[model samples]
Target: MPYVSMSALLAFVLVYGLGLGPIPFFIASEMFEVAPRPAGMAWGSLANWGGNFLVGMGFPTMRNVIGPYSFLLFSAFTMGLFLFTKFYFPETRGKTPTQVAQLCSRGLRSRPLTTATAKHIL
Candidate 1:
């Protein structure tokens, strides 16, 4: 039991440290070009901290109301975020901002551009 608990904690910490913790700071900058990057980053930071504040403030009341099932609520939240990211977030690492915006603007599912379309955008 202890080993399982410790392993789960370590796994979560590693995932958070490597992915969640750092991604927010840079992702907004990538999403926007020079003109609006600062505003985008500021808004993103505010949303991130606002969410943290809400979760911190609400978790205790939620736990009391939901009891052991409180974790289920958070699990559901995590799953929703996972699905949102997987479905809505574009792969921006190699894409230019224009390309990223075009890909994202298409809606729920994004498609790969053909050579002509890619050339037009890039």
Candidate 2:
């Protein structure tokens, strides 16, 4: 690839990866009914870092094992996970703790909160 093309590819990957990567954990926190507390936040952060570390630590071996096409598979899996979350995860905002817990536990789909839901909850 040309220099400009390479730069564009790099930028695209950076933006795309950063934008969609954290979503799984954001959904997980809701799905798991993690309380909005310091400890909960700490646990979430720990989980995120742990995953990051595991991937980073294994990247070289994975790259060698899978070759250049590994990233394509990785991206595909990431997008699949995102789509799965979008379809299955319940929105948690504006819900009481009990409601959130129930939604998470029962897998009951709640419509995502709008301004009206925010107003009602507030």
Candidate 3:
């Protein structure tokens, strides 16, 4: 197989293999406490579909504007977003539902975790 095809295949495998299923699970698990159960699930599903639709529908335009590496550019942006969220977003694992909601409403500064402090916890 050609290098491009192999690279593409590898990218697909890496994305779907590791990323496809885990993100929603992680987000849902975390957000469930911050939002009501029903709202959390609804928002999670909406965000998932919205993001997928936006990326799929915008691909052609993105490609045209950004050229052949549009997917790579998107991936980079996504990675940055994920990292930013991971570092800045609070970990709600053991917190009560009310506490989580309060944290969300008030942002990280009002709670225990912030980007600067996340490194210590994680």
Candidate 4:
């Protein structure tokens, strides 16, 4: 790859770190009830760090073994996560924990929230 291409690719981490790095933490915080939130956040942070460590420690070897295909592996995983979130993850903004849990349990099949449903749930 050319210098500009390499630089552009490497620059993504800066953008991600600045713009999107806190989103998972925010989501995890919002997802749990008050009684369990501390523990939940701890576990979630641990998992996040574990996954980061895996990528940081394994990426070089993975790249060596799979060459350019390693990026495809990441891309596929990201796309899968996107689809999973799109389908099953509930909107938690202004919602109580019970509502969020109900939404999650109902899975991807839950219909769009109407004002009546929202009012009733609240």
The numbered model that scores best in lDDT is 1
> By TM-score, who's the top model here?
4
TM-scores across all candidates?
0.66, 0.56, 0.61, 0.67
C-alpha positional error of residue 80 in candidate 4 after TM-score superposition, expressed in Å: 0.5
lDDT of each: 0.77, 0.70, 0.71, 0.75
Which of the two candidates, 1 or 4, achieves a greater lDDT against the reference?
A: 1
Badly placed stretches (over 4 Å) of model 4 are 1-10, 101-122
lDDT by residue (30-82, candidate 4, tens digit) is 77777877887888777778877998999999999999889899889877876
Clashes (backbone N, CA, C under 3 Å), per candidate, total 0, 0, 0, 0
* Cα RMSD for candidates in order: 7.5, 8.4, 4.8, 7.0
Where does model 1 exceed 4 Å of error?
A: 1-17, 105-122
Over the full model, what C-alpha lDDT does candidate 1 score relative to the true structure?
A: 0.77
Report model 3's TM-score to 2 decimal places: 0.61
Give candidate 4's TM-score: 0.67
* Best first by lDDT, ranked: 1, 4, 3, 2
Candidate 1's residue-wise lDDT over 1-122, tens digit each?
99999999899879877876666677687777778778988988888788778988998999889998998988898888865675468788788888876765675574565697567645
Clash pairs for candidate 1: none
The ten-residue window of minimal lDDT in model 4 covers 102-111
